[model samples]
Target: MKTYDILILGGGAAGFFTAINVAEANPRLKIAILERGKDVLTKVRISGGGRCNVTHACFDPDELVKFYPRGEKELRGPFHTFASGDTIEWFERHGVELKIEEDGRMFPVSDSSQTIIECFLEATKKCKIDVLTTQSVQSVYQGENHWKVDTNQEQFSCQKLVFATGSNPKMWELLQGLGHSIVEPVPSLFTFNIKDNRIKNLPGVSALASVNVNGTKFESAGPLLITHWGMSGPAILKLSAWGARILAQKNYQFGITVNWLHTSDAEEAEQILRDIKQNQPKKAVVSKSPFDFPNRLWESLVTASGIPSEQKWADLSKTQLQKLSTELTQSKFNVNGKSTFKEEFVTAGGIDLKEVNFKTMESKVLPNVYFSGEILNIDAITGGFNFQNAWTGAFILARSIS
Candidate 1:
């Protein structure tokens, strides 16, 4: 059987980061990455629509931890150790310049994920770290003072073993065999599917709004995009991440309230509507939208409020005004299902967080065993936050190993 000082499973972001950092810290130690698929860094190549959201612009560790719905408390200390600023400096030193977008998402100046992938590949080659692909892990266990991992190709052992395989069920099962608790994976960062007239033919229509999963405390406020399937964007994605478990328990069938005006108070919206009626009495209610959002959306809401297309603001009755106010401030929709956000898929479960040490990113249940990335019960909403989590954990784990 072949052997190495370090063996990292999963050649994705976390795995690659850990391997490269470990090799850099301990140049004399032998290291290898075992990848199941023929291609490594597939997720990195496709993230951010091929742009590769390297990290978010948030530099504060306290604020950065807020993005992660699951790993918030546990990651507080780790982020302080290696946050977004550290990530930027690391990439800069590696000859990859990162630029921050208006939305606070940082991407390579090249705007191509290939740049990031190529950088990783070059680093591995330079560090003499073996990146063995198509080596699916069969089983892994501790033996004497080393960790033994059997794969489809061959058997390998290492003094330090790391599992960065994000959301792999087979790996979770293997970990469970070794006395680790799996959190039962569930879908996170998904868009709601709703077939509603208010949103029909309104694909791509986006606005700043507040959304709440009806009958629950899960609520978010941000830019909500009306998609062909239903609603998406930061507002909905935040709610989806924060409520992943609860929504899964409900079987993805639930009700939600959309505050079109970005506020929950219907009375406040009603007062604004009354003022509009008094100021623009002769103007057709559907002719122009009084709000800052898209007029097409306003027209749809007006029609849904039982107002005639040609009806002027002067002819609006009290009930019609009230209905319009409610529709504007608190429109309700029944979500029947969900759709994955673009090509990105994240999960809300993995090895339980309690089983790992955040400071060292080492397994508390087993010595010399480490985990990083989604293998732990940690995930964040969209926007480069997930990648940041991977970097932070991998860096900390690499330090511990070295």
Candidate 2:
């Protein structure tokens, strides 16, 4: 049996971050990370379509926590300890320069996730931490002094154990065995699926939108995309995150009201339509797109409003104008289903945060056992926020786990 002072399960972002920081905090302690997969950091490699969004530009801990749907209150104190600013400085110190885009997502200047992976691997090597791949953990039980972990290849023991396995059903079973409550995992950050003809063949059309789940209080405002399947982009993704649990309860079948203009008042949209009709009577209703919307989408909206393509703006009746205004302001679509946004499938459930000590990210019920990343019931809207959670928890766990 291999024994180490510290054992970290699942060698993804959180696991590696914890292992590296722990080794740095205590150079004498031996640390090893056991990865079930043949490769490590697969998610990081594919995140942001291989660019790997490292962290967001939000520096304030209070403002930062707002992005998270779950664990917002729990992560408040932890973020103060190791937040986005610390993340930026940490990576910069490691020779991986990060550049923040206009949308506030920070990535390696090289625009490659490999830079981040290389930095971690080099840091671990410098710290002499052992990382074992293809080490699938089967069971975990606490011994009187150290933790006992049985794996497919071998048995291992450690003075401290950390699980960053991230949404793995088998790991949740292990956590349940260890007396930790596992919040039922549900899909988050998914795009709505609609078969409405208004968006058919309008895959590339996009506009700023405010999307709200009709019955729920959940809502989001940002750029919205008319995907080949349905709707996506920041607005839809944020709504998906905020309503992950409730929508799951509804079986992914729900109604969403979309404000394509993202404005609260429809009266302003009506005025814009009237002004267009008065000023450009000779122009086709679809000719000069208003509201800064894409030309194709304006055409689609006009068609949906029953406005004839060749009809002049001057020929619009009172009913046609009202219909056009409604379509622009509050276009309702039946969200019959959902589709994956990119390849990332974020979940809004995991180890219940109430059972975790935010100060150390250690289990309140179990000693010498810690968790980070998606293994915990913490998730956020699409962006670098998810990765930031992993960094914050792992850093705290590294410092607190003696």
Candidate 3:
């Protein structure tokens, strides 16, 4: 049997960060990370299309916590300890400078996730931390004075243990065996799989809009993109993240009301339509889209409103105008299923928040056993918020454990 001062399960971002920080804080303490798969940092390789979204540019801790739907209140204290600014400084100190995009997602200046991976590997090597792969953990329990972990290949014990495995059911089960309650996991950050003619053949079209799930108070407003399958982007993704459990309970079958004009109300939309009718009376209704929407999308919405291909603004009756206004302000679509957004398969459930002490990220139910990343009930919308949670939690765990 092997032994170490600290043992961290999973070799992903949270695992590596915690190990490195703990080793840095206490240079003489031995640390090792056990990874289930042969490859480590696989998620980092595909995140942000291989660019690796390190974190967001949001510096305020309170503002940062707002992005998280689950751990908002719990993370308020931790983010004050080690938030996005700390993450940026840490990466910069490690020689990996990050650049922020217009949308606030930060990526390495190298524009390659390999840079982040190499940084972690280098830090681990410098700290003399072992990263063991293909060591799938079979079980974990407190053995008197130490934490005992049995992997498929070997057995080990450590004074302190950390579970950084993100959204792994087997790990959750093993943790449950350790007397921790696991929240039922549900899919989050997915796009609605909608099949409708209003958006058919207009896959590349995008617009700033507001979307709300029917029969629920869930709502979001941002840039919405029309995909071949349905609608996606920040607007739809925010709704998905915030309503992960509710939508799953609905079995991914529901209806959504979309406001293409974003902040425009029904009355405002109708007034704008009437003004356009009076000014552009001779022009084709579908040819000149009055709003900032794509021409194809406008034509489709016009068609859905029962308007003909060559309908002029002057020929529109009262009913046709009302229909057009409704289509522009409150379009409805049926969502039959969901599609995973790119490679970001985030879940909204894990170890219950009450079972974790956010101050140290240590399990309240198990001493010396810590949790971080998606292993906890904390998840956030896209744009590097999830990774920020990982960094914050892992950093706090390192401080407490070391």
Candidate 4:
């Protein structure tokens, strides 16, 4: 059988990066990436609504690690080696320019995922890294000081094996057969699907709000969007990322409290509403909301608060004002289910981080084997953090292997 110095499974960001870096670092090393999918970087093409959020702009390694909800502890060491700054430099060195958005998300200057994909393809070609597509690895076995990889097409031998197959179950199963510990996988970064009139007609309405998941454990404040299905945006996505495990345990069924006004608390928000009612007492409640919420959203909130649109704030009693304040500030919604945050849904569990050496992403239990990317139990919040993990882990492993 033909032998290679490095064999990487999965042609996603991590695998391609590992192949390119290893080939560049060691010119004589024979590196091949085997991808089951017909097209490489399929997810990359669809990530970030097709803009491909390559990485976050956060430069501090410690700060960057906090974005990952799962592998924060394990990724601390890897981030020190290769973080967002490294990602920027690597892409720029290869001729792909990236720009950071106001929200700290970094995307290609071309605003096209094709830019990132072509850069990887060109880098791989320049480095002479072999890429095999439509090759599904069935299993992996250790051979004396080497690894025998069995695929649907054929079997190959490699001195080093790297699993970057993303969150695929079969990949984890293959690794488990090779005696690696894997954490049970679960969905992360999803939006809540709630059926409520409070946000029904106002599909595109969004507000800077604070979301408290059951008033404990997880909390985030950002742009909260009201979609036809339910709620989304930075606040909702952050909630999904942070409470991925807890929500999964609760079977995606839970109560979510939203502070639409983003005031300190219910009492504080109630005082603000009371002041508005007193100040704008002559105005119709629907025509003039206390906060700068959208007209449709304000009407919806008023309707949900059991107040008529024609009711004058001047005629509002203390109890009515308190009710409106409660509805505006601490509105509780039942999240009966979840829907994908577009096509960029990520999972939060994979190969347990404790079993892998973060310095090199190599398996501590098995020599000559490494793990990187989403294949491990590392998942981050939205805003390019997940892609950063892939780049960081792959870069570390490539350096160590080379």
User: Which lDDT values do the candidates have, in the order given?
Assistant: 0.95, 0.91, 0.94, 0.88
Model 1 Cα lDDT, one tens digit per residue, 1-402: 989999999999999999999999999999999999999999999999999999999999999999999999999999989999999999999999999999999999999999999999999999999999999999898899999999999999999999999999999999999999999999999999999988998999999999999999999999999998999999999999999999999999999999988964889988988999999899999998889899999999999999999999999999999999999988999999999999999999999999899989999999999998989999999999999999999999999889
Please say which candidate is ahead in TM-score: 3 or 4.
3
What would the TM-scores of all predictions be? 0.99, 0.98, 0.99, 0.97
Residue ranges of candidate 1 with Cα displaced over 4 Å: none
> Judged by lDDT, which candidate is best?
1
Report the number of clashing residue pairs per model: 0, 0, 0, 0
TM-score of 2: 0.98
The Cα error of candidate 1 at residue 303, in Å, is: 0.7
Query: Measured by TM-score, how close is model 4 to the native structure?
Result: 0.97
Compared with the true structure, the alpha-carbon lDDT of candidate 4 equals 0.88
Tens-digit per-residue lDDT, 174-256, candidate 2: 88987889999989989998999999989988899998898889888999998888998999998899999899888888888
Better of 1 and 4 by lDDT: 1
- Please, what are the lDDT tens digits per residue for candidate 4 over residues 1-402? 668989999999989988998888999999899999899999999998898999998999989888878988888888888889989999999999899999999999999999999999998998888899999888788888999988889989999999899999998887788788888988999999999867777888888899988946899989999898899999999999989888999998899999888766768877887887778888998885557667777788788888887899888888887787788888999998999889987998889888988888889989989987999998988999999998988999999999
Please estimate how well model 3 matches the true structure, expressed as its whole-model Cα lDDT. 0.94
lDDT for 215 (candidate 2): 88
lDDT of 4 at 393: 89
- Candidate 1, pairs of clashing residues: none
